[model samples]
Target chain A: MSLHHQIRQYLLDQAQMHGWLAHAKIPSERELQTKFHASRITIRDGLTKLESQGFIYRVNRKGWFISPPRLLWDPCHRVNFYQQARDQGMQPETEVVSVNPLYDAPLIRHQFGMDYGNNLELLRLRRLDGRPVMVERIYLRQTDFPGLAQQPLDGSITELFANKYQVQINHESSHILVCGTQSEEAALLGIPEGTACLHIERKRYDANDRLVDYNLEYWRQDALELKVSSRK
Target chain B: MSLHHQIRQYLLDQAQMHGWLAHAKIPSERELQTKFHASRITIRDGLTKLESQGFIYRVNRKGWFISPPRLLWDPCHRVNFYQQARDQGMQPETEVVSVNPLYDAPLIRHQFGMDYGNNLELLRLRRLDGRPVMVERIYLRQTDFPGLAQQPLDGSITELFANKYQVQINHESSHILVCGTQSEEAALLGIPEGTACLHIERKRYDANDRLVDYNLEYWRQDALELKVSSRK
Candidate 1:
């Protein structure tokens, strides 16, 4: 491998081990040249390649910094979270936070397709790897999944849909993008108020056109990445 | 039409005539009952429906305000600006801000697929729905369209691609979300500094795996809405 590629890999390994994903200003070109024992041109070549790949960026006078790649989600596909992570070569993990019945709220009323007075249920959590990157609040229709709160939901909700409910989520449409974390959201994602987060408000329905699940996934901007390979 | 629909349309028409998107708060339930000569429940129901559909969102102590739906561009599809606007039932218009050839900047060099020494031509603009919504800075590879700088690029670049270079951009990937308007971006978007704006970064390519266009579209947050329908 080339010297620049070697240095790039070394830095990437360090980042992976330390679990740092946000942009970081590293040593200047002169310092990198002396430390990596490479020419300035080679260092620039490596930095430029990393920037193009959405791994790092130069901020005017501030030398170079690591950057998380943008995450590309195809609204056309209804793939689950774990599947989406695996496709991107990431280790997908989950932990249960809370599962409780929702009572007399607008959110629950809408999720359960219940009458104005009917009840609903919710599962909220701080989903993460080594660090919490997202807070997922899922509202499930109680009529469709009775006793779901009593079952083990720490694993895959997709698997639950298939094996337990015998339902197949063939398609889903998501409204996905970024937003400044609100006070409540910030606390859950373990970030400062006004930190950037990728918010995915998704509606998962069954084959019969019933609203089965609604999810709000707040992903930490620093810890996630996505790419798009468009079809012609 | 129902009284609520009449009121909604009245608000919308007023918004259009004033050439702005936001509106004064609606009369309180008591006031609405008197003005519309309807029950408070009816007025509340109408407001609730609109809020659910994202036509409006609450602002804590402040009452309801008209919300323009955001434009959700699917990165998987090769949809152009005009098509995106048309889908939202809005008339999209553009004014050419400036078109010039540039070179030497690393960012420009990377975007236009230019050699370190090559020149790139840019077409800048403030786009609108009969009123300004965004300012776009578009960079083109001069190698692909040698005489592009001399053409009338005031119209859609997609048309220019077809006519000048015989290239049809079949797919585009975009990063679309809210961002605080930087000083320079604010000046271009005609908004105050720190105002929220939608920053859309896109890379367009043709059918043969060749990068053809690059665009940065910065839109005022209050100026647009995004809607996506997904089936599960």
Candidate 2:
């Protein structure tokens, strides 16, 4: 085996044995180089390998740190963002980016089985513990919920719908794909372009089986873990 | 907006209106350039933008083609490999890369509540319609199903377990994350290193609520779409 590979294995063993907590800083490259008696390039290669494998991440010049524990989410549960984060012992915050009336959006019209009028679009940026993790774009049919555009758009939409509109979300159909983040999303999340992300498209329905909202969520890849329990 | 952006929008409109089927070849670069009276660089830039958005892909010397329709998969469904592929109108094939007895797998032993000495590892490469889609690594306890390592490793392990040991999987717990593909998995899937992929870790249990197997699956990003239905 190569020197870097051997060094990587050693670091991995150390991480496992010491129970290196999330966000803990690993040894500096210089320290690792001196300890292994290896060249700078070898040490860098080893660290890069570890980073790509999800063991560590670099924060510009801040050096390498153990990756944070991913937020465990169960999409099947009707829990809102606030409850989900609180359940995992993390602070959650939401910033409403923009809210505008949309007209003549063919896709949104088709999804809600309406034609060309009275739609509201809401864009929000969500963070966990002050780290931006997801960007959400939601479209709602205005005719179904009069004056929805006037309501405060921050915080949990699910709770807002239930409290004000008395519309309980009964079902959700979601599709998930992995892709490179676009420039706009990258800028919002403070990540580089082409960073891998999970793109989720969902159609939410009310208790009457009406398509109430269509949502698109772009999530940072390393920050979340989607959990599902299957029954046979 | 830039000229390339305008051109990309026009092409997108065309794709949606004309029902451009998946895997169909789009107009060549020369054709696009001539039609738009644009330079080679401008046309290439627009095409590259589309490719990165998952609208199309390049096949080396074969030019660009529309990306194939992603296979819609519901992980909660108790469907085997063969049934899942056929349900999506595709052929499925599996090759057993290797199988061996594992004695000192600390994690596996801990999960199965065993000390050591009786574990089996199986590695498989799976394809849909002749295109590599996923690589799976499964670890099973030998004491639970004696002679498991000696059984035929090809085809569906779900069926094999039923017929050989009468062990029906009753529940599965899964965790999903998105990350850049590793070198070994990239090579097997015929994709470039560091390509985005969905990594799923699953724990399978039998009717008695005993842990039976642990599996890790790496799936190509563009080849599959995970679907989930949440009921409230």
Candidate 3:
């Protein structure tokens, strides 16, 4: 095998072995060059191959780090996303990036049952164990919650709905696909612009069959593992 | 906006309007340069951005073509994938690429109820509307199906098992993730190696609750739209 191929395999084996893995940074290109006596280009080629394969990611100045196992998601789980992560022994965090109001939004207006085409959007940045995982934009009508803007934003919206407003999620429909990150999302996720991402679009309904929520979530491609029962 | 951005938006508007799109080849870089009086780099930058955003794709010898909408997939659908695609007004095609035998595969042994670890693997390439969409690898134990090698390979395995073998899929568990395509899968799907893809791992059960089938499907990221209800 070529030197670059050898380097790729060696790094893969290092990652597969728990001893050398973790979100830990691998050797720098200079370090690898000195250790392996290979050209800088060769080392770079190996690292680029690894990055494209989703085994590692580079943070602008921080160099490269081993990617963690994707967070497993089961659509049948009855809890919210954060709780689900916690159940898997992961520390999940959610921050309210921004909250704004939308009026006369034509495309999304029909998705809701409200007579008026007015809605509130909550932008959230979420992390798993300190690594940026997802950025979610949640949309809902302001008329549904008169004082929603006054409520705390950093907490779980699901829990807040149940405890504060006597609301619960009955059922929801979702669409998942692969897409590229735009500038805003790229900045939040710490990935490059146009990086491949897992895009999820969801709509939640209440007992009365009212469209209670609509959400768009963009996740780092390596951070999501989706498990579904069936959808023809 | 810069000339390249203008070129990108023009192509996007053309595709979204559905007037000039239909998988038809867009102008070549040289043609685009003449038409827009822009540098070759400018034309390429626009096309590159569109490709990265999943708006278009290129064949090896052919030029760029607009990408179609993702095929919708629902995990709760009662029918098989091909049937579902048919219902959506798409011409689905399946081809048997290869089949092989395996022995002493320890990793997969316990996933089946069979006492022995010997199994057979069926490799298939599936297309939608003449576009290669997925490459599937199916694994099963030979002891479960006598004379399985003689069975027709191109048709639906789900249908074949039901009609010829009296085996029906009762329930299945599946995992989905965003991954990079390997060389074999990339070759079959006509995509570059390390391209982002949607990876699905599924295990199907029979009426008797035995693991009857194990399948791994690699799909072009732009070709799949997955819908799941909940797993949290």
Q: Compose the digit string of candidate 3's lDDT tens values, residues A1-232.
A: 5554577677777766857755888889899999789888668666755665567877767788888888888755545777889888789998889898987677777777546656888999999989988999999888877789899988788788888888888888889987778878988988767666789899888887788889999988788898777522
The residue ranges of model 1 lying beyond 4 angstroms of the native Cα positions read A1-93, A103-120, A127-130, A177-184, A190-197, A206-210, A220-230, B1-69, B72-91, B111-119, B127-132, B163-165, B176-183, B191-197, B221-232
Docking class of 3: medium
lDDT of each: 0.62, 0.77, 0.80
Candidate 2 stretches greater than 4 Å from native: A1-67, A115-117, B1-67, B115-117, B180-183, B192-195
Clashing pairs in 1: A70-A226, A71-A226, A171-B232, B69-B224, B69-B225, B69-B226, B70-B225, B70-B226, B71-B225, B71-B226
Restricted to chain B, the TM-score per model reads 0.62, 0.76, 0.85
The best candidate in terms of lDDT: 3
- Model 2 agreement with the true structure over B1-232: per-residue lDDT tens digits: 7555676677678889989877667888899988889888678766654554566665545677777777788888757778877887888899888887886778777887743557888889998777777888899877767877688887778889989989988998998887666677877877656555678899999888888899989986667788888754
Query: Each candidate's chain A: what TM-score?
Result: 0.62, 0.78, 0.86
Predicted candidate 1 versus true structure: per-residue lDDT over B71-114, tens digit per residue: 56664544677888787777777777677667456786776553
- Model 1 quality (TM-score): 0.61
Best by DockQ: 3
Please report the TM-score between candidate 2 and the true structure. 0.77
Q: Residue-wise lDDT of candidate 1 within A79-126, one digit each (tens)?
A: 566677667655566767667667657855765554343344454554
Question: Which of 1 and 2 is the better model by lDDT?
Answer: 2
**In terms of docking quality, how is candidate 1 classified?**
incorrect
